[model samples]
Target: MYYSREVAHQIEKLRKGFPVISVIGPRQSGKTTFLQHYFKHYSYFNLENPQTRDLIEQDPQQFITLNPKNIIIDEVQRLPDLLSYIQVHVDKQQEMGSIVISGSQNLLISEKISQSLAGRAAYQNIFPFSLSELQMHGLALPGHLDQMLKGFYPAVYTREIEPNEFYNQYIVTYVDRDARLIKNIQNLSQFQKFMRLLAGRVGQIVNISSLANDTGVAPNTAEDWISILEASYIVYRLHPYYKNIGKRLIKSPKVYFYDTGLLCALLNVVEPQELATHFLIGGIFENFIISEFKKELSARGLPVPLYFYRDQQGREIDLIFESKTKLIPVEIKSSSTFNRTFFDAFTYWRKNIQAEISGYVIYSGLDSQKVGEDNLLAWNKLDTLIDHL
Candidate 1:
C-alpha cells in the first residue's frame, strides 16, 4: 500500500552529484519507508533503538568502518557528533551517494550538516503527502473540507488511521518527546496550551506579546515555542512582501500549520460538516490552498518565492510569488460564488508595483473564468496556477 513519492527523481539527481543526501521532514512523513523502498540495496540503521545508539556512541569510527558505503541512518540527530565521523568517511571514500541521513528536527540536522558536512551533503525535504500526490492514487477525498480534515499524512491513507487518532498521538509524541529533545520546557501543559492558542491564530500575523499573555508565559517563552514549532515542521511563517512598496507594511509574519488536518485537530473540528459553519473556515481554507502551493513548488525542487502582501492601510493580497522579473499576486477565498471585489487588492497593488506578471483569484467553485488581465481559478485547478507561476 505504498504510494510513490514525487521527489524520487529530484533525490536521485542529488545523489548522483553529492556524497551524502539528507532526507529531512516531520516524523511520520515516510522518510524511513521511502528510503527503504527507494534505496533497497542501501544498508539501514535506526538510531532510535537504545542499543544501536549506544553502539555508535561508543565507537563511531568502528561503526563507520564496518558500514562505510551505501548506508541509510534514521534519526541521525540522535548522535549529532557522529556526523563528524561520517564527514571523514565520505571525504576518505570520495563516493557519491555513499550515505543517507534522515531526521525530523530540521534545525539540529541542518545546523550539524552546515558545520560538519558542509559541501558534502545535499538536502531533500520530505513533507506529508501533497494534494497532487494523493490524486495520482485516486485517494484524494471528495470535498476540500474532508481533505483538510483527513490530512495528507502517509499513515492516514496507507495505515488507514483515523485523523483524530493519528493527530492525537502525533501531538503527544511531538510535545512530549521531540520538544524535550530540542529544548527544556519546565511546563509541558503550558506548551500544549500555547499550541492550541496558536492554532486559533492561523493565517493571521503573529503577535508574540499577545500570544504570551494568552498562554500565560513570557513573550520570550512564546517566541521560543514558535521557533521550536518551526524547527519541528509543525508550523511555518509566511512573511509579507515589502519590496518597493512606498507605504508601511506589516513586519510580523503570518503563521500557518504545515498540515491543515493537524490544524483542524488543534481547533477541534472533528467532522467535515463542521467546517461549513466554523468561524475559522476561511483561515483553514486559506491554509489549505497555500500549503498545496508549497507542496507543488517543493516537489519540483523549485524555490518557494512565495509571500503575502499587506500595507498599513489594510490593503492586502493573500499570496505573492516574487521572481526576478515578475511578481504574481494571488487572492484566496473560501466562498463558492465568484465576486468581482476579489480583485480589489490586485488592482491596488498594480499601481505601485511595476513587475506585475499577472494576478489570480482562487475560490471553492466549479467554474473558472477570466476577468480583465488576470485569471480566476477554481480551487481544484491549483496546479494551473503553479504552472502559470
Candidate 2:
C-alpha cells in the first residue's frame, strides 16, 4: 500500500554526489517510511529509542564504530552532536553514499547541519503526498476542490484509517512532541491556541500585531512562534510579488499550512462535508492548492517563487508564479460552474503586467477549456500544467 514519492530519484541522485543527505519534514510526513523503503540496504538507527540515545550519548566513538558505512540515521536531530563526528568520518573515508539522515524537525536539524555539516550535506524537504504522486500510485486524482478539503496527507489519501481520528491524533502529536522537541516553549496551551488562530487566518496577509492581539501574546512572541512553525516545515509563507510596479504593495507575507488536514483539524473540520459548508472553505481551498503547487515544485528540485499580485487600484490575482522572464497569474475559485466574470482579475493581470503568457482560472470543474485565450483548468490538472511549464 506504499505509494512511491517523487523525491526518490532526487535522493538517489544526491547520494551519488554527496556523502551525507538529510531528508527533513514535519512529523509523520513519511520521512522514515520513505528512507526505509528506498535505502533498505543501509543500516538504520532510530534515535528516539532510549537505548540508541544512551549509546550515542555515552560513547560517541562507539556509535561511529557501530556504523560501518552505508548508514541511515532516523530522527538524527536527537543526536546533533554526532553530526560533526560523522562529517569528519565521511571526509576521512572519502566515501559517497555512506551517510543518510532523516529528521522530523527541520528547525533543529537544519541548525546543526549549518553549524556542523555546512557544505557537506544535501538537504531535501519531504512534504506529504502531492497530486502527481497520488496519480503515480494509480489513485483517482481527486478534483482540486476535493483535494483541498480532503488534503493530500499520505494516510488520508490511502484511507488507512478514519480521517477524524487520524487528524485528531496528528494535532495532539504535533503539539505534544514535535513542537516541544524543536523549540523550548513551555506554554503548550498558548501554542495550541496560536495554531487554531492561525487556521482562521489562512491565505490572508499576515498581520502580526493583529494575530498577537487575538492570541493575547506580544507581537514579537507571535512572530517567533510563526518562525518556529515555518522552520519546522509545518507552514509556508508566500511573499508579495512586486517589481517596482508603482503601487504600495502589501509587505506582510501570507501563511499557509503545508497540509490541509492539519489545518482543517486545527479549525475543527471533522469531515469534507463539514468543510464544504464552512465559512473558511474558500480560504482552505486556496491554501490547499497553493501548497500543493509548492510541493510539486520542490519535488522536482525547483525553487518555488509563489506570490500574489495586487495593485492600489483594487485589482488582484489569487496566485502568481514568478518565472524567469514571465509572471504567470492564476485565480482559484471554489465553484464548479465556470463563469466569464472569474477572469476579471486575470484580465487585469494581463493588461497591467503586460505579460504575454495567458493566465489561468483554476476551478472545481472536470473539463479544461480556454476562455478568450486564457486557460481554464480543473484542480487535478495542476501537475500537468507544472510539467508543461
Q: Which is the leading candidate under lDDT? A: 1
Residue-by-residue lDDT tens digits, candidate 1, 269-370: 899789878999899999999988987888778775888987778888899887666889999999989899988877677787754556999998868998
lDDT of 1: 0.89
Worst 10 residues of 1 by lDDT: 242-251
* Per-residue lDDT of 338 in model 1: 89
Q: Which pairs clash inside model 1?
A: none
What are the root-mean-square deviations of the candidates from the true structure over C-alphas?
1.9, 2.3
Screening candidate 2 with a backbone cut-off below 3 angstroms (N, C-alpha, C), the clashing residue pairs are none
In the range 1-389, model 2's lDDT, one tens digit per residue, is 67789988788888888888999887777888888888888888899998988888898877887784888898988889999888888888768878898888777889899998887899988988887787777764454545555666677766678665787788777778877876778888899899899989998888899999999999999998998888778797887778854332447778999988788878988766788888988888888789889888888887757888766675778898877777788899878798999888766666667757788888877779878868898877887568656
**Regions of model 1 farther than 4 Å from truth:** 244-250
Global fold similarity of model 2 (TM-score): 0.94
Residue 169, candidate 2: Cα error in Å is 1.3
Which ranges in model 2 have alpha carbons more than 4 Å from their true place?
140-146, 157-160, 244-250
Summing lDDT over every window of 10 consecutive residues in candidate 2, give the lowest-scoring window: 244-253
Error of 2 at 71 (Å): 0.6
